[model samples]
Target: MDKAEILVIGSGPAGLKAALSAAEQGAEVTLVERDPFLGGQLVKQTHMFFGSKEQYAAERGFKIAEKLSREVEAHPGIRVLCDTTALGYYDDGVVSLEVKGRFATVKPQSLIMATGAQENTLMFPNCDLPGVYGAGAVQTLMNVHGIIPGKRVAMVGAGNIGVIVSYQLLQAGVEVPAIVEALPHIGAYHVHASKVRRMGVPIYTSHTVLSAHGKDSLEKITMVAIDQDRQPVAGTEQELDVDVLCIAVGLTPLTEILFQAGCKMVYIPELGGHVAMRSDTLETSVPNIFVCGDVGGIEEASAAMVEGSIAGLTAARNFGYGKDSYEDQLAAARRELDSLRSGPVGEKIRSGLKRLSSFGEVTQ
Candidate 1:
């Protein structure tokens, strides 16, 4: 068993930020990552982030991860456990994990679950083929492992993940046939959409895959434009010869532990499914444990980092490990959170925040 003043699970942008913040506040922090390396999805992100300079926007995500890792390495108060998957959590802030092929348990005074989000899969005829993969998996293969998943690919979903991965595939010398979206317009940023468009990858709006055909592997795909009701229109079927089908429709929060631990949940499709109702401090229904990052909801890395900091600082304060000015530190964290959620896309997040805020009264 291992113990720390603060235990942060996941080691992505959220977990790293959480651990670093807590350490800076003089709390002993242990950061656990499921992967053999730290940086979670940040390592997969090869593109520059958007937002303000304070958030390291315009910098490539891989570079940002390197910088963050360096910070964590410099901090003596922070212990990073790589290749450790936190299997589950208990009500007493105790966690069970598999660490480098060994079983381990941790009981921390404060817990921050930054387990991040998982890909939301869409089902269609023959969608379960071997050549099909989540957009994130494609990234992991190309960016991390230096291996291309396939030569020609048809990406299903024109959202940010789909768009970004398509561009990255092009970078790695893979051909992207088309990005199919069931909506009339691309669901990602205009800049990302334009980048793929300029590269000659067609964006098929109001379209959905009818079937992905292949015996042992994916050999081709048939797609068609659909009406507002998502029913395929007649005579719009087109077959694209591609070996891979990448699904990037969206992400869902990895909230199984939160649910298992008996945290109150509210399902908001906009927020990407059942998330713990949290206070301004990022405290969940369970008072001593906090939830942050994509596990809270699917948002940008910028928002995830801010939320992680909020959870870490709040955790430190809860454990009586912070300075006399801990309240002021928390106030600063709140300001950071507010700034990240104040953009055009933030209107939807405001609704999520409102939903999460309601959890407090239910407990009282």
Candidate 2:
């Protein structure tokens, strides 16, 4: 058995910051990551981050991960775990996990769940073919593993992930024939769409995957245009001889653990499917189990890190680790998070969060 003053699940942008924040606040923090590597999606993000300097703005994702690694190493209060997965959670504050194939249990006084989100999936004939992959999986193969997902690709969904992955496909020498989106207008920021267009990849708005054809694996793809009602138009079918079909529809939070742990769950599309209800400090309905990052709502990595900081400080105060200035630290973290969510991209998040907020109703 192992123990810590605080336990942080999923070492992504949020978990990394949450563990570090609690450690800095004088708690013994245990940071666990399921992947063999740290940094989570940060490992695959090659693009530069945008925000204030305090949010590590202008730094590329991988560079920021390296910097976070160094910071985590410098702090003795944090214990790191890679290639570790939390297998189960119990009502007694016990989290069962397998660390490098070795089973262990951890009992933490406070728990911060930053388990992150899973890639959204799409369905069609041959959707389960070998050549069909998520944009994140393709990014990991190319950017993290230096292996191209395919020679030629048909991308589905023109959201930010789809757009960014399309650009990355170009960077990796893969051919993205086109990106198909169901919405009439591009679903991504203009800047990302512009980058892909500059590379000469066509953006097909009001389009969606019709089907994929292959014998053993993916051999070709078919797409069609849709009307304002999102129903397919009969005469707009288009086919491409592409071996790979990358799907970048969207992301959904990992909410199973929250349900099993007794946290209240609610569906909020604007917040990315179903999310665990949380207060301003990120605590869940279940005692001692706090949620941050995409698990609470599907926000950007910069925002996830700030949410982590708030949860960490909240956890610290709960265990009497940093009561003297918990309020001050928490206030500052909240302010930073609010600032990050003030832009147009954050409008949905603002409305979605209003559903679960009740921070002033109680204290830790």
Candidate 3:
């Protein structure tokens, strides 16, 4: 059986950092990505990130991705597999994959799952309309493909993705009529809210989109004020003549592989959806199998990268690489992640993860 010390999936911030760190610390690593190009979600993120200097603070997402991608490519200890999809994981870290149009299997001593996340959808009339796109899909079209989704857009949900995508639409000269949120207050950071507000996109709190109108495509949308129970109030419906309805309600972790391979899973609405339970080093219940980034929980990219580093470092340490420095690096990464998941906004994530790991001393 062909084998390597480490195999990483997704090549997002988490996978990139994990693979690179694993290689730097002493393992022969293979980093695989399904996309033709590298960088995962970072490739389509045009805005600067918010974090400390070590986390690529103030740098744009695309730039940080590019930098890490270069490092991954130049590292002789690592192999890059673009246009690759890991189809299955088995006992002993055996993975079946489609690589460059050919089916293959990889046997690695350790495996890291950094598959990231996908956009969530909301149920509504005509939700399957042609012009209704997921927030990530809309962001990809405008930011990556350089094509605006539509002339006028209505952003559903005022979470970070919704607000950021709305701001990006403005930069692309697209019209954003409003950002609708079912909650009493905007869910995204104040910085994001203020920027979009200053640009004239009204934030409608306690509002919910009830339907998207038109046959075969989106022509307009209907929304209403929601009551305290989150139910639509009577006689509060409003219709907007928007071309596209972008749904950015939330995201869900891409942890199917982990689930298939028999890892413990937990559902945490705050963390997006079902996530794999892992240790501080990011190792899942399965021995030598690790998870980080959105696959573990739907945190931001900065947190994902830090988690990736921890997973890689810990994996390397287990394999007898950088034995002295591994623990120190892992501790630092954990500290950084803890700091990021603090404060008022991070309370939900912190609590969710705590619940996931509450059952101590697990083995598989």
TM-scores for all candidates: the values are 0.95, 0.96, 0.97
Candidate 1 — which residues are off by over 4 angstroms? 358-364
> What overall lDDT goes with each candidate model?
0.87, 0.87, 0.89
Range of the 10 consecutive residues with the lowest summed lDDT in candidate 2 = 355-364
Candidate 2 Cα errors over 4 Å, as ranges: 357-364
Residue-level lDDT tens digits of model 3 in 1-364: 5687898998999999999888998888989999998899999999888876889989999999999999999999999999999999876667899999999998988889999998888899999998888999998898889999999999998989899999999988999998999999888988998999999999999999999899778998999999999999999999999889999988899887998889988777777888877776778888888998988888889999998898888888888998988768877887888778779878878887777777565566
In each prediction, how many residue pairs overlap at the backbone (N, C-alpha, C within less than 3 A)? 0, 0, 0
As a whole number from 0 to 100, the lDDT of residue 174 in candidate 3 is 93
Q: Top model by TM-score, which number?
A: 3
On a 0 to 100 scale, what is the lDDT of residue 334 in model 2? 78
Q: Residue 219 lDDT in model 3?
A: 92
Q: After superposition on all CA atoms, what RMSD does each candidate show versus the true structure? A: 1.7, 1.8, 1.2
Better of 2 and 3 by TM-score: 3
How do the candidates rank by lDDT, highest first? 3, 2, 1
